[model samples]
Target chain A: MDRLRQHIEQITPLTNEEFEYVKTFFSLKKVRKNQYLVHEGDEVKYEYLVLSGIYKVFYVDEQGKESIVQFAQENWWMSDYYAFFKQKNAGMFIECMEAGEVLCSTLEAREKLSADLHKMEHFFRVKLTNGYVALQQRVKLLLSSTPQQRYEAFSHLYPDLIQRIPKKFIAEYLGVSRETLSRLYSASK
Target chain B: MDRLRQHIEQITPLTNEEFEYVKTFFSLKKVRKNQYLVHEGDEVKYEYLVLSGIYKVFYVDEQGKESIVQFAQENWWMSDYYAFFKQKNAGMFIECMEAGEVLCSTLEAREKLSADLHKMEHFFRVKLTNGYVALQQRVKLLLSSTPQQRYEAFSHLYPDLIQRIPKKFIAEYLGVSRETLSRLYSASK
Candidate 1:
């Protein structure tokens, strides 16, 4: 909860009393490695705020090919937001990559917090703004970057993620062949 | 400014007085066809709300290949957001595809509105949420979808855009070759 307060305070400061109230909306849960948090077709009830370890938000096609939507770690939020906000069944899957703890909160709770506190609304808005920028960068990289440029950008942006995640998923995320990933990796060495 | 009020009110209703105050922060401009709202290396000072226009926000690579980030029409917000929000030089370009009008507002005005009014904050947050979901869908499509699937999804999502944008730009936006795009178009027929 202290970490959660720290995360929120990074954008907007909350009074101690206010944070106590905000923390109540979030319930903590342990995530085991390989555990499925949100499964396709399941109701997406809550968005997770990662406290530690890594998680992959992804989609599996009819032919069973996987596309990684994002890799989230500490202080990051993860959910099938298309489902979470609309109260629909999940169209994607979220899987725990390493054991960690996450604080879960419902969309209703998110809205309530915003309505109840202007600071909370500002906090959420700021977070969304950063997320929007990151997604824009992702689209640009995916569309125009060569494998080497992509690898370098990824390495620069998420050096920790590069060290932590498997090369297979990294290859998929970069939209490069596994062989190409190997060439980039060995060349970077 | 009625358009601005209506667009914001789609997510969070605003009083006439409040909207009047909000309108002061925006300046309306008539855009000519092929006009660039933003260009690479220029300072991105404002985000635009398309009052009446078809616009493409895109990036051109070193080899002069263009990739469309988004095709925004009436009621859509467009900008080099990475630069706009951060007060940095633009990394992309936004060009008008059809002559129309846009309301431009700076980051300061945006922050001022969000800070001054909770309803305005909610409005911006909701808009960002929708944009985030759309980007996520795009990332998924780009990562694995076939040309036919991409074309069909684009057609379904933006039938209006399909009718307005050229097939060449459409092919580039979908990350498909002109030949493949032609095949998809004829096959659909």
Candidate 2:
């Protein structure tokens, strides 16, 4: 689990024993492309750490429109965080955009880890703070940027995802139509 | 300091010694009505806990149109968190809508608290996690709710703030115009 070790190091370096203790809670799972991990209205039972693959966190409006909120590639964490920690029904659906593997930990295991290891608790604490900061920036982006600017920002933020996901998904993530995205791309070119 | 004790109690019980240690960093500050506490693009050096009064967090567009993202009332925390934590220019402006008092803490104090007090560190971690959940739900509401539905939801979520803030500010918070908010209010009645 080089990826797991590296991910934990990004927060706070852990000893081999400490990593092993934390690793006891995580189990690797494979998801096929287009498969659902968690659906809207279901309780999100696990927080996933991407090992290899892409995932999209999105929601369907009452009128059946899909709005993509986030894309989690390798090294990113993905979950209906609102549901996972709160035990509430998810407002978003998480699905595999490309077949991939993820290290999964349930809420029970996470809580137990918090009680058993203060270091794990601190790791998650730093993660949540960083997560909070990221969402605040996203909200600001939605408020301050134009659709064209958003596209450019998206391209810069996830350069690899640009070639991997369909144009429609990118358009939806930027809150624009496919046609608008095409026009913006051509204009920039 | 009474407010800090109360706020901490709402989240988790802290011992008197722990609370006292945490309280040393905060100083009382008064913000005048219509004055900015933190501005977009300014480095956010402090985070405030509202002791009394109301504040608005908003961003202005290129056209100078303001959209209120949130309003902080009594006992709520206020900051351009992105800037406060990241040491970057803030993306939102925080202004006092009504003259108020707050307890302020700087980034240095925040880091020191996390290192010095495990209980305080745990308390903030839980609080930030809750904040992240609330923000995700707000984004979901924006995606799925109509203006009327959003106003109704907002009414249910912050009836106290709605009663205290000006209608124009509420409209901005909901991403609607004054006329639209008026219609929604009349329709509800």
Q: Chain A only: TM-score of every candidate?
A: 0.97, 0.94
After superposition, the stretches of candidate 2 with alpha carbons farther than 4 Å from their true spots are none
> Please, what is the TM-score per model?
0.98, 0.95
Q: Name model 1 segments beyond 4 Å from true.
A: none
Worst 10 residues of 2 chain B by lDDT: B136-145
Q: Rate the local accuracy (lDDT) of all candidates.
A: 0.92, 0.84
Best by lDDT: 1
Per-residue lDDT of B64-139 in model 2, one digit per residue for the tens?
9898777998887879887888888887899998998999999888778876766666777888888898787776
Global CA lDDT computed for model 1: 0.92
Residue range A12-59, candidate 2, lDDT tens digits: 788898888888889999999999999988888899999988999999
Error of 1 at B169 (Å): 0.8
**Docking quality band of candidate 1, CAPRI definitions:** medium
Q: Worst ten-residue run, lDDT, model 1 chain B?
A: B1-10
